[model samples]
Target: MSWRRALKDTARSGIAVEKKRLEPLIAVRGAAGLAIVIALSLWLFGPAAAASSAFGAFQAAIATFQRSWRPRPELAIASGTSLAVSTFLGYLTISKEPLFLALLVVWTFAAGMSWAAGPTIGLIASSNVAIMLVTVTLPTSVAQAAGHAAMMIVGGLVQAALIVLFPVRRWGAHRDALADALAAEADYARRLRHDPVASFDPQPLMEARNAAAVTPRQARRRPAELHGARGIAERIRPVLASLADPAMGVPAEGPARDRVRELLASAAALLDAAAHAIRHGEPVKVPPAALATFRTPDTGSILAGAPYRAMTRLNTLLQDVVETAGGAPQDGAPSGARGTARSAETDDRSTSGRAPTHPGARGTARPAPTTRSRPTFLALIPKALKAMRSELRRGSPVTRHATRVSAVAATGYILGTWLPLGHGYWAPLTSVMVMRPDFSQTYSRAVARLAGTVIGVAVATGAVQAASPGTLLSGALAVASAALMYLLMRTGQFATQACIAAYVVFLLGMGGEEWTQTVPERVLLTLMGGFLAMLAYAVYPAWETPRLRTRLADWLAAQGTYAAAVFGSYADPSASNAPDVRQALLTARTARAAWHAAVARATAEPVRHRGLSRTAADDAEDALAQLGRVAMLLEAHLPERGATPVPPAARFADALRESTHQGAKAIRERRVPTWDAVREALDAWETENPENADKVVRNTATLVLDTLTELSEALDTAVPPMTLDGTAPEKPDGPRNPKDSATR
Candidate 1:
């Protein structure tokens, strides 16, 4: 490769990195409106007035940032409180450097660690760095400090007003969430086309659904998008799994196969169409006659019996999606967006496994349990503080991250004080913002921050030169620059950092700070901060990937407990404890969430030290997902309607309990577990009766055990698959499934 060619390749790669979207017309108008407002304000108000108002305007601009799709009162309050408190702290400590710098370290640490509390609190804590710079070092008097604080509060209020008035970005994130989920389902459908009968992993699409659910959903879009996609997929997965079972003896590559293939392809197309419509904000456009394929016996039709039952349900789900696009809940449907979704995954989780969670494979679930009442507004403070205290006590990764951030930021603060720069606070601010709990995120931010600062400094200098007619012109230019910054902020972290740098430059320039002086100082301080943050991470980092194996072990242990608790419910439906079952599910969900988060962080970790290969990691993650699926099924499935409630047989119940016990022991002890009663029961059930519904339940139970066994063996923790009641143990070093022996 020639040097010139290499350079060209590098340039091309850089350009391709940013996937620019065609901005919606409304979005463009919103940006223009913001620019005009800022420019006009500066032109009308003198520089002092404009600069003072900016403390409000800048914050207002940021209020409409990532995932802030709705009017969240708690968020508004949190933001206001953070800004006020941070500014007050700065004002109090400006003349007391030793005290302030020490507090800065502690404050930053808390901010960094607050990520454990979820996105909302984390955003609030992140405001501390901004206050440290804009409030603490700059505020000259008590009156000025109070005045600036009031103005900033007003700015946040203004942003909230704008949101209500314009409503341009309403449900934008919600729309994307639905579109992404549908698109992921479509992709999964495509994969299924090649292997119509085989049991492929459903983790990727499952994950997309999980992520979509985690977002703040609009109440209106919830019912259609929530349970509809994941619920339908979960329902369909087992139908395919059961159909693929060799015990059923359904021939491959027949008329049924061809019909199933067309249905799957059509399902994929339908999902694609829905995804397109949601993303473009158009009504779902699918033929109502599309249902006729399942409704009538046609060419290449497999519409009969259980498959037909599933097919009809699929049609109903499609109708639900279309209705969602049209707006509001249809007749006989659950109200609210996530209400039905809350039950979606939990229902039919055990359909693939008859672990007593769903022996008859019935997928209907009771309504979601009512949530605890919301605390009064004042109670939020105590609740948040209590959460903080609890988070600190746990010697978990969140605690460690908080400690790292505090130490690094404090060091940066001290450095700023020692160094001679026009605006030394930028160093500590950079340190605080650049260092993140996520290792990959931290590194990326550091790089972006540096590049953005350099670019911003240059841009600010040029703008100042071009627009410096007087104070009014200077202030107007600054406001215009701020609007430009807002336009680019969410485009990418790199773009955001660049815009922030320019915004700050232009903002200070309105206060009569010369571009030549402020630009160099700003760039230098930013570079120092970025460098310091990177160095700190290199010295004392918490790598999630290295700890993934341990987290997986914890997940497996939790799964064992969850499975045991759920199976106990199956043993005697009359004795089933709803609260206990719910608790077990919540535990499993927590464990599952933790393991997935760890896997994500590990994948994003530096390649040389990422620990696990992507393939191995994905397999582990998928196995965990399968376990969660079974757990969900157990929670959602209920006893058959009007049937005499007979207890699950001792043989079945004992095997389940023992299997779960051994699985847990293996994960904790790092020894492979051997099956005994489980194998015996499966063998007896499969061979004894071939044409009973009870036999199907036993087969499902066996399938679930087989999957768990495979998962355990994959981790090299399984001893063998042998009868625990005196049969010679067959030890296998690698993973294997129980033989599909179906002799009738």
Candidate 2:
């Protein structure tokens, strides 16, 4: 081979190798960002310079442990006991023989508990053990070391007690908040059917749905509440099912159950109708008959008897708003209100020779859509289930991304400990906690770490100055400083507060070393740690944006297909196959969740892939919003019930299928094709009338095209062309991913 060719090959090979090397290092760097700051603080101040640093670490560990402990009391007792045992064991191992073996045992125990019970317990127990061992070897006198250990035990006990007693009252409050939020969501959904002005943003609605669905499960621990709600839903579910059935109509035996079910069905229908109206930007008309049903005393009685009274009230309010919007004014106008004046004018006109006339009243007044002739309860259940499933699936991407992050953190922690960097033990710990793939978190951690180190230095300097050089007073101050550091660590705003307290105690304990002598060294070490963390995070960063975009495209396609099926059924009553309709609805909901996940991933990692930044993500999200609007519009145009209508199912399916396919193709290519071409293609597909087999193929093709277009736009903006190779590249002299294929 020619030397020129060989050189080219060599350069190409080298680049590939470098890329591979950088991948893992990037992950490590991202993870290590905070650890570097902590390490720098320790190195600059020296272990002895910040005796309180140890105490701060201990407190931070305990706080983490407490958070992980499910159901407060068990966590407190477990964390406290573990802390005491680990500290005592660490002290014994350091002061006596078999130091290495003893350390191993403590390490193993901490690791096991951390993995099994949760991070909070493991961190506290491990830090205590590590600190106890380190203090034994420090230049401090045995008596001084003993005093420091005693304070840690006391602080741990106090923290544990506090955690157990109060147990962060927010959990229950959050549950209630979630419930209220869900209630609001249901009301909003109901309003959308009738009120054209009501905002049709699905995000808040989706959030509330997810919250309600999940909260109920979480609150299930409160068996009484859970059972009560479940019982009501269960009882109402069967009755509603019976009423929704075409053959059975309404059940005659259970009057109350039948009535409640009818109301719920009516409410659901109203919500569906509102959603349709909002999507189409058209006014919703509430029939006079529907208003009459609500005006009855029985309506209030039925609503009051329901498990979710708030939901019922919200439904009623939404109906009233819709009625008003439709130009049909209801009773009980506010005193001296304009509506009352209008009513008086109408009455006066009726009494005189002329007839009452209003510009708003154009269309003929019709009775509200009746529940009497609606489909049976069983029919609606499948549709509801489908919607619920779709909503749940939307968060899958976030869950996956979080899982990956946590796994990386756990691995980094284990590796850092195994490496056993002397006097640099905190480096790995800091990195794991601080480095996040998400830029916002990464930036926050880095800032906090830097601030903490600076404060720690200042505090250490002051303590050293006040205590005097090499005095007993210095040692006492060190113990007091440790306690103070412990307190600061609990606040959890920034790393600097705890660092300040820790560094001050360390200096005092170290016999009041001159502040001028050690400040620079501490700062330098901190910088080094930060650099290392950055390297680890950047080298082989795992970008989740691309995957998220792809998932969303698939979801959108599914929703489009479902919309087509619903529309198709509307066109042909003979195609009264409810199962297909139900499945389509479910598919649409799942698509909604996928879209949400994609948005969330983009939001979290705003700078993941070059063009796939926050801006791109937002654009993709906007497109999804449009798609949802389209789906709702199609549903609204469909006939309520009758013979086959215009826009057959086959045509709708073809358009949606092409749209989805196009979206997926776009993502894979990382290029957003002009959606106009795809949209035209769908329109053409719908225009062509074909046989059943041909129609299915055409429909599938349409969905594929649409998906491809959406996917392309989303991915093109999120994932950079260079990073599309699905591999992390290495950089010179950088920590890299061990798992890189090129390395192998």
**Cα-based TM-score, every candidate:** 0.78, 0.46
In candidate 2, stretches whose alpha carbon ends up further than 4 angstroms from where it belongs are 1-70, 73-164, 167-170, 176-422, 460-464, 467-522, 543-617, 629-662, 671-744
Q: lDDT by residue for model 1 over 1-744, one digit each (tens)?
A: 233443344333322226556344434443444444345445654454446546554654554454443344334434654676677777787788888777777777778767775655675677556545665545567776776566556555555555556666455665676576667666666665575433344444444444344323233344433434444444444443333333333346677656656666676677677777766777666643444454455732444544454454454455455454443443433232333334445432323222222322333344442222235436556776777777875556677778877877777677777888766777878877777776666767777788777877777678778867456566555555556655665466667677677767766766676777777777888888888877776677777866765677677666656665555555455553544655565566577778878876665555342334465556656665666555444433333333233244335556755676666555444444556666776666556555545543454465557667667556543223334453535565532454533331
lDDT for model 2? 0.41
Worst 10 residues of 2 by lDDT: 347-356
Q: What RMSD does each model have against the real structure?
A: 6.9, 18.8
Task: Quote the lDDT for 212 in model 1.
Answer: 41
Q: Find the number of clashing residue pairs for candidate 2.
A: 111
User: Which pairs of residues collide in candidate 1?
Assistant: 222-337, 223-337, 349-633, 350-633, 672-717, 672-718, 672-719, 676-724
lDDT (CA) for every model shown?
Answer: 0.57, 0.41
* Position 327, candidate 2: lDDT: 25
